[model samples]
Structures are given as structure tokens and as C-alpha cells.
Target: MSDDELRELVHRVDLRIERLDARFDALEKRMASVEGRIESLERTMTTRFEGLETRINTKASNWVVSLWGATLAVLIPLLTLWW
Candidate 1:
């Protein structure tokens, strides 16, 4: 093959490589954006779950305390009668 023809082929290959590199860079930017959004969503979900857990714990504790109070109110009177 002629030197000119070989040079032309090499130049074409270089252009193709540059285009591929640009495409890769664009893809990387898009992936980074998606990763950032996912992280934000995860943080929001975690905060919401933590708040829900706190509410559930508070409600359960209140229920237990109320139940204990009611049980004692009934048991104490019965025990006194037996005594």
C-alpha cells in the first residue's frame, strides 16, 4: 500500500478513537448523575424509615405502659379482697 493511503487510514482510525472517547466521557457523566440521584433517594428513604421506626417505638411503649396500668388497677383490688 502507498504511504499516503496508509497515513489516511491511520488518520481515520484516530478520528474514530476520538469519537469513541467522547462518547465514553458522556456516558460516564450520565452514570455519575444517576449515581447521585440514587444516593439522594437512599438518604431520603433512610430518614423516612428512621422516623417511622421512632413513631412505632413510641406507640408501642405507650401501649405497654397503659396495659400495665390497667392490669394493676384490676389485680390490686382482687388481691386485696383475697387478703
Candidate 2:
């Protein structure tokens, strides 16, 4: 190819390279935003699970105590009458 044609080709290639670089930069920014959102979602779900676990544990203990109280209330009276 002539020198002028070669120079034109190089110029077009350089322009294409610049456009590709810009696209890569934009993709990196989008990925960073997505990563931040994922981290926030993870933290929110973790908090919800921890709270649910605490409530379940509290309810289980409360039911156990209530059942024991009720059993005693019924048994003591029956035993006294039998004696």
C-alpha cells in the first residue's frame, strides 16, 4: 500500500482502539456498581435471618416454660387429693 493509505489505516485502527478502551471503562464501572448492590443485599438478608433465629429461639423457650407451669398446676392438686 502507498504511505498515505497506510497512514489512514493506522489512524482508523487507533480510533477503534480508543472506542474499545472507553467501552471497557464503562463496563468496569457497571460491574463495580453491581458488586456494591450485591454486598448490600447480602448484609440485609443476613440481618433478617439473625432476627428470625432469635425469635424462634425465644418462642421455643417460652413454650417449654409454659408447658412445665401448666403440668405442675394440674398435678399438684391431684396429688394432694390422692394423699
Candidate 3:
């Protein structure tokens, strides 16, 4: 091929490479954005789950206290009557 033809070919290849690079950069930005959103969602879910666990624990503690109190209330009077 002539030198001029070779130069033209090189220029076309360079243009293609630049276009590919730009496309890759755009894709990378999109991926970063998606990753950020996923992380945010994960944090929100974790917070909600923790709150649920705390509420359950509080309810269980209250139930335990109430059951013991009721048992004592019933048993104490019976023991006093028997004695």
C-alpha cells in the first residue's frame, strides 16, 4: 500500500479505539451508580431489620415479666391460705 493509504488506515483505527474507550468509560460510570444504589438499599434493609429485632426483644421481655407477675399473684394467696 502507498504511505498515504497506510496513514489513512491508521487514522481510522485510532478513531475506532477512541470511540471504544469512550463507551467503556460510560459503562463504568453506569456501573458505579448502580453499585452505589445497591449499597444504599442494603444499609436501609439492615436498619429496618435491626429495628424489628429490637422491638421483638422488648415484647418478649415484657411478656416474661407479666407471666412471672401473674404466677406470683396467684400462688402467694394460695400459700397464705394453706398456712
Return the clash pairs for model 2, or none: none
Runs in model 2 deviating more than 4 A are none
Worst 10 residues of 1 by lDDT: 1-10
lDDT, residue 38, candidate 1: 100
lDDT, candidate 1, equals 1.00
Error of 1 at 32 (Å): 0.9
Listed per candidate, the RMSD to the true structure in angstroms reads 1.5, 1.0, 1.4
Model 3 worst lDDT window (10 residues): 73-82
Question: What tens digits encode model 3's per-residue C-alpha lDDT throughout 29-54?
Answer: 99999999999999999999999999
CA shift at 78, candidate 1, in angstroms? 1.6
- Compared with the true structure, all predictions reach lDDT values of 1.00, 1.00, 1.00
Q: Quote the lDDT for 77 in model 3.
A: 100
Model 2, 1-83: lDDT tens digits are: 99999999999999999999999999999999999999999999999999999999999999999999999999999999999
Model 3 vs. true fold: TM: 0.85
| Model 1: residues with Cα > 4 Å off, grouped in runs | none
TM-score of each: 0.85, 0.91, 0.85
Model 3 alpha-carbon drift over 4 Å, by segment: none
Per-residue CA lDDT of model 1 for 3-82, tens digit only, reads 99999999999999999999999999999999999999999999999999999999999999999999999999999999
> Evaluated with TM-score, which candidate comes out highest?
2
